[model samples]
Target: MVSRAHPHGDDDIRLLGDDSFEQSDEKDNLISFDDTSGLRHRGPSSSHKKPLSAARSVSPSSAQDSPKGPVVAVFVVVFDAKQGNRIEWSHTVDGSVDIGGVEYKALPSGAHTVSSDSLTFKIGSYYGVAYFRTETDKSSARGAVFRSCGLLGRRLEDIVGFRTVLQSELSQGKHSTGDYHVLEDLVGGRSDFVDNAFTPVMERVNKSEIELMHDNKIVRDFCTLLGADIFRLWKCVLLRKRILILGTPPFADLCHIAHLCSLIGNYDISSPLRPDYNLLLYVDLNDIDKLRQSKTFVACTSELIYQLKNDCYDVLIMKNQLHIQDPALQRTCLTSAMEKENFSELMHDYNLRSSIMHVDSGRFDATEFVGGYFTALNEKILSAFHAADCTAEQTIADSALEDLSLNPASDVPFLQALANMHCPSIRVQRQPLCPQCHLC
Candidate 1:
C-alpha cells in the first residue's frame, strides 16, 4: 500500500505531512457525488468558434468546439498556511467525474515562491490555466493568502476567457459573494450565461486569446530568437533528442517554447510514423527519476541546478543559447548566420504584409506561415526521393539537402529514415521503373 503521507513521493506538493492531510472537511463536503443525470451539455453557440483553416485541415482533433461551453471545471488552489497547497474549491460540469491527482498540477511547481504570475499547462487530456495572486489579509492564517484560479478544459483556446472571469470573481471576495453564487447558473446550462459573463472576453478570444493554435506573436518571437538555428533545433526534435529548457520564475514562456519545439518538423499532427512529443511542462530535482525513464521529451525547469544533470538531457536551452552534448550536433554558426540574413528578408516582407492587413478586416495568421516552412522543407525532402525513380532518389535528396544548407553526410540519412517511416503518408506513390529495362 502507498503511504497517504507521500503518495507521489517527496516531489509532491508540500501537503504530504500536514495535519489536514488525513482529515479535511472542506475537501469532502464541497463536492457531492451526484449522478451523471444532473449534468447537462449546453447547446452549441456561435461564441465558441473553431480553429484556423490549416489547423482544421491538419487534424480534426486539433479543433475542439464542444457543446459543454469549452470549460469542464473551474477550481481554486491556495497555498494553505497549514496544509501547504490544497484545492480550496472546485465545480465540474459532470457531477459524477471526480477531480483527482490534478490538484498537484493545477498550480505550477514553484508558484508560491513568486509573487504573481499566470501559466497554461497540460494535465492528461485536459489543459489547465492558472493565475496565481498575492493579497494582503491580516485576519487570515498568514498575512497574505496566496490563491490561484485554475480552469480545466479540453478547448485551451476557447476557455482562456475564463481565467479573467475567475480572477475577477476571486477579487470580489470568494467567501460571501463568492464562486458558488456567481457560477451556480452554469450548472443549469443557461444559454445566456457564457454570452453575459464573458462578452468582452469572447470578442477578443479569436483575435488574441489563441494559445496553441495560431498566436502569431509566439511564432514570431520563437523564430526571431532561434533564427537559422531553428532548422538544427527542428532536426534534433525530429530525431527524438532529450531537450531541457531552463528559465526564471514564470515558466509560461518556457512551456510555450517547449511546445513550439515539439511542433517543429511534425509534418502531420496525427501521423503515426512519429509519436507525439513527450512533454513535461515543469519538472524539478524530485522528478529526476521520471526524466530518466523518458527516452525523448521536452521539459522545462526553473532551477539552474538541473544544468548539472548532464546525463538526463541531450540538449540544454538557456538564456538564448543552445548547448548540445554531442560534438557532431554543435551549432553551425556559419550556416546559422546565413540563415539569419535570409530570415531578416522574410520578416521584412511579413511586416509589410502585416501593416497593410492591419487597415483591413482580414488579419494575417502566422501559425501556418511558420509551421508551413518546415512542412515545405519536409515535403521537398520526401518528394525528392519518392517523386522520382529509386535510382536518382539519392541525387535528388542530396541536391535538396545542399539547397537547405543541411549536411548531406548527416541529413541524407535522416531524410532516408523519415522516408522509410512516412513514405506512404509523405508521398503516396513513387515513379515505377520501366518494365523492359531496370532504369525508367
Candidate 2:
C-alpha cells in the first residue's frame, strides 16, 4: 500500500526494474519480471465490453460500446517529481502492435525530455500500463490496458506479462544492457502482427470520450488508490464531503443516515454539488485551492496515513488517539468491538485547536471513527456560518424550501447555561485536571 509519499525514491527507481536515470544508456538491455505469482485477483467482468472481430485492425463502428478488440487499451499518466499523478493520455494497441506504434509517441513525449518510457504492471494482466517520463521537465505519462483477469481465453497474469513485454520491445532504440530484460529480442515489428499471433482485442478511443472514461482509471484508480481495492474506494468517495459514516457490516442505514443529516440541516455526504468548503480530500481527486481554503480540519486519518503523507501538504498534523486498518485491503482489519467511544469530544478538542476542514479515509467504520468530529463541527458550522447563509439564500433558492426553512429556536437550555456563565465566549470551558486525584 505504498503511497505517492513513499520515503525511498531511489529504492522505487531500483524496484521499478530500472537504475538511476543518470546512468549511461545501453544499446540492448533486459529485465524479466513477471508478477503473476503475486496476483490476488482471479476474475474479470466482460459483460460490458464489446468484442472485436479481428486483431489486426480496430473497428470503430461498435458505437454502442467503448472500443474493444484483440489489442490492449493503453492509458498514459504523467507524474510530478515526487511522482504524484498528473496529466493523462489513453490509447488502444494490439498486443502484437507495440504500445509505441499506437498513437501517444507522436504527442508530448517527443516534445518533452522523456526520461524513460517503459511498461509496468499490477495484479497480473488485470492491469497493464506503459509509463513514460521527462525528468528535467517533470513530465510523465503511462498507457494502461484493462481486461477481465480471465476472459476470452486470456488468463489475467498471462495478458499482463505479454503486454509489458510488447511495450518494452517496441521502443525504437534497444534498451541498454543492465540489470534489466533484453526485450528487443522478443519483439517483432508491425509485420509480425499478422497470423493472429500474440495479438490483443481493444477498441479505438477518441479524444472527446477520454476524459469521461479514462481519467478516473488513471488519476484516481491507478494513481491515488493503487494499494487500495476498488470496492471500499467507491464507498469512501461516494459521500465525498460529508463525514462518511461506514461500518464493517456495510451500514444498512447509509442512505437513511444521510437523509437524517439533511433533515437536521447538516451537510449531505452524497450530494453532488462541490462544497464551498470540503472536509474530506482525495489525493488526486481534489485540487490545491480546496486544501488551502479548508478550516479547522487538520490531517486526521486513522487509515492509509502513509498514502497521504509527504505530498507537500503544510497543514498541522493533529494527534490521533486511535489506530485502524489500511484502506487498500478488501476488508477492514479491525472489528467494531475495538472502536473508540466518546469520539465526538476528542474531535471537538482537535477542531478547537486546529480549526478543522476535511477528512478522508477507508478504514472500517470510518464514519464512526470521525463521527465525533463531524457531530461537533455540525453544530459549529450551522450556528456560525450556515445559519446566516441559509436565511439569506433561502429566498432566492426555491419556494419549496421556504416552507421547510431554517428556524433556529433561540431559546434553549444551552443558551441559559451560556448566559449564566461569566466568560465572553458562548461555550463554557473548564480547566483540565486529573480525574483520579482531581488535580492537574
Candidate 3:
C-alpha cells in the first residue's frame, strides 16, 4: 500500500480561469498604472469633498480590523555617484503597500509577482510559490528550484537584455569597440593587473547615482530620448593620468611630456573647473620662496586645490608663476599660465633637473651646482678666510714667506714669472735647498 501525502491535494484544488473571475474582485488588489487621469482625484484634496455622514459611518477600530487585502508597492532608490549599489527596483510578495514598515517576505505556499520600474524588464510579471511542509523545508526546496528557473527565466533575461542594449549604445560613440580587432587589441595584449584596474573604475562611473538621477530626470522630461552621462568621460581622463604616472615610463620623462602636451593648444580634457586644461601641479610651502625668486620660475598654482584634497591620491598643477605666500592662489594662476609655450621650458629646468644633469654637454656639469657642492666649499673656505681677514698684513706676509722658504721648489714658477716681470730676486744657490727651485 502506498500512502500519498501531496500537500496540494486534487480534491481541495481550485482554479479560477482568467476570464471567469468577477471584474471587481480580479481588479481589487491590482494597481492600475493605466488610470493616470483619475489618480489625481485619489489625492488628499479629494478627501475633503466626501460627505460627513460617510466619514462618521466607518469607525477607525472597525476599519483596522477589516481585512485590508494584499497591496503591491513599488520603491525606487536612486543612488549618488559614489554609492556602489546597482539595484534600480525591487518588490515583495502579498502585494502590500506597507512600504516603509514591513520587510518583504517571499511566499512559500502561494504564488506572487515581482516587478521593477527599470526599463530592462519586459515581462512585468513573476510567479513564486511555497512548497514542502515546514518553513525551512519550503525555503530550501524553493531556493534550489528558484536558482535555476527564476534566474534564467526572469532575472537573467532582463539583465542580459539591458546589458546588450547598453553595449550596443556604447559601441556607437567615438571610442566604441564594436569591431573585433579593436576589442582584441584592447584585451589580448594587456597585462592582467592593467585590465583589472580599469574594470572597477569604469563600473563605478557607469553606475554612479549622479548618472542615474540625470538619466531618470531626462527620461521623465523628454519621454523616450536617451543621453549619455558626461561624468563617465571624466573617468577616462583620470585613467590616462594614472597610466602616465604609474606606467613603466620615468617620472621626469612623463612630467616633461605632460608639460609639452599643455604647450601646443591641446590640453583639453573636459573638466568643469578648467575645461581646456590637461595638468595641475601643487607646490609645497618650503619650496615656494626659492621658486618665486628665480627669473626662470613662476608659481601658477590653481585655486581649485581644495577639490583635489578629498578624492584624488596625487595632484599635478602646471603654471607660469607661483607665489610663495599663497599656495592655493598660485595653483589657480598656474592653470592660466599653462597655455604658454615658455611654461614647459620652466618646468623642465626646475622639475627635471636630475634627468638633465646626466646628459653630456662638454661644459661644466650641472651636478656641481647642486647644494652639496656649495655646502662643502663653504665649510672649507669660511674658517681660513676669517683667520686671514683678522690677521695683520705684515704677519700674514711673514707667515707666507716662511712657508715659501721651507718649500722653495714650489716657489720656482712664481719666482721665474715674477723675474719675467722684472721683480727683485734676493738670492740664488748652485745646489738649491729646495729640490726644484734655486730661489727660496
Candidate 4:
C-alpha cells in the first residue's frame, strides 16, 4: 500500500542510468542473488521501472500492508553521460554502480543509497556517502581525481579491505617461480621435494588425539568457526575441545588469538593442564592465555588430573611454568557462535529432550532461558568456551543463558560450541557421549 504524497501527477520521479538512454529496447542492470553468499549481481534483463500509479499512495510511516514497519520515501535523481559521468558495473562488487574501474560511487542526487553485494553506501549528515561529481581534484592522490562521493560510508574502509582480499585471490597461481609449465618436470620436482624434505621426517607422532582422515573409518562430523572474532570459538577450541592448530598465520586461517586475549586480559583456569601439543611450530607458553579444562591437554592419553589446579599465565610455551597470579574466572566474552541450520535442528532436539527431562513447559529462545534444557545446553558450551563470559558467569546449577538468541544467529552457537561445529576454518573435536563422564 503506497500512500504517495501526491496522487494526481506522475510526481513519483523515475530516474534511469546512462545505459537506459543508450539502448532504447533494453533495460537497466538487474540485480540478482548469487548462491554462494546471497550477494546481488546484475542480470542480463535488468530493468527496474515501477511507474507510480496516480491512484495509489503509500503511508508516510508504518503502512499496514508492509511486512517491515516504517518506510521512508527517497527521491532518486539519476546522473547521465551529459554530466561527464556514467555508472558502470564494478568488478570487486556485484550490482554496484561506480565511476571508473572500482572508483567512488555516483548515487542519485537525493537518493538515500545505492548498494553492492555486501555493502550499503548511503547519505548521512556531515559524513554522507554515495554522491558523485563530474570534475576531479588532483590534490588527493597521484594522477587521481577526487570525484567527491559522500563521506563516512562503509565504502571508505570496505574498499581497502575488499581490495586486499581480492588481490590475494587474483594472485593465486600467478607462477612467480617460473616453473615453465611442464607436468613431467613438476611431478619430478614434487617427488624430489617429498623424498628429500618431507618423507624423511614422517615419523609416528606420540599422544595422538586426531587421526588422518583416510586412517579413520568413521565419518568425521565437524562444526565451523568463522573469522568473525567471536569469543565462543576462543573457549571452545583452546579450552574445552583442545583443537589442533592444523593451520596457522601466513600459512592459513590463523586462530583469532589476538582478539581473544585482548578481550579479557590473560587467562587463569581453576583446573590443571598439561598440553600435549606436538608441533612443527613452537608457541610461547607466555603467549598462551587459556588452559585446557579437561584435566590435561596431553591428548587424553593419561587420565591423571592436571597439575597446578590453579595457574595464571600471560602465554603458554613448552616446558614453561605458569606465572602465578590471583585466580580469576575465565571470560566467555558473552558472544554467541550460533548458525541458523544447527540452531533449528538443536531446537527440535532440545524440545524433545526437554519433554523427556520434564523441563519443556518453559521453552527457550536465544534471548533468555532459565533452568531447563537450555541451562543444560548452556553448561555444555560454557565449560567448552574458553574465554571468560564478559557478562555474568554461570554455574551449571544456577547459571543463565543470555544471548541475542531472539536473532536467528543464536541457534548456531549452541550447535557449534555444544555440538562440535560449520562455516569456514571449521574445527573437528571429540564429543563427550560417555555417560560415565560429566554431562556435556
RMSD of each: 13.2, 19.7, 34.7, 26.4
Clashes of each: 0, 41, 27, 38
TM-score pick, better of 3 and 4: 4
- All candidates: TM-score: 0.66, 0.21, 0.14, 0.18
Better of 3 and 4 by lDDT: 4
- Model 3: per-residue lDDT, tens digit, 1-440? 11111122123212211232222221221111122211000001111111100112223453343222111122222211222112222233233322221111111111111111111111122211111111112443233111000101111111121222223222343122222222222221121211222221122223344433332222121111101111111112222221111111111122222332222222122222221232321122222343333322111221223223322322232221111223432221222121122223322332244344336422221211211222222223222233444555311232232232212233233223322222122221112333443223
How does candidate 4 fare on TM-score? 0.18
Score each candidate by Cα lDDT: 0.54, 0.24, 0.22, 0.23
Model 2: residue 196 alpha-carbon error in angstroms: 9.0
- Tens-place lDDT per residue, model 2, 129-236, is 333433332233333211111111122222322333444443422222221122221122122321233433221222233332222122211211122222222222
86-197: candidate 1 lDDT, tens digit per residue: 6666677776444554555555455555577666665556766677767888987667777776666664554545556666666776743344545433322342335433
Once model 3 is optimally superposed onto the true structure by TM-score, how far is the C-alpha of residue 42 displaced, in angstroms? 79
lDDT assessment of candidate 1: 0.54
* Candidate 1 similarity to native, TM-score: 0.66
Order of all candidates by lDDT, from best down to worst?
1, 2, 4, 3
How large an RMSD does model 1 have?
A: 13.2
RMSD score of candidate 3 (Å): 34.7
Q: Tens digit of lDDT per residue, candidate 4, span 339-393?
A: 3333444434534543543454432221111112223333333344433332244
Task: Answer with 1 or 4, whichever has the higher TM-score.
Answer: 1
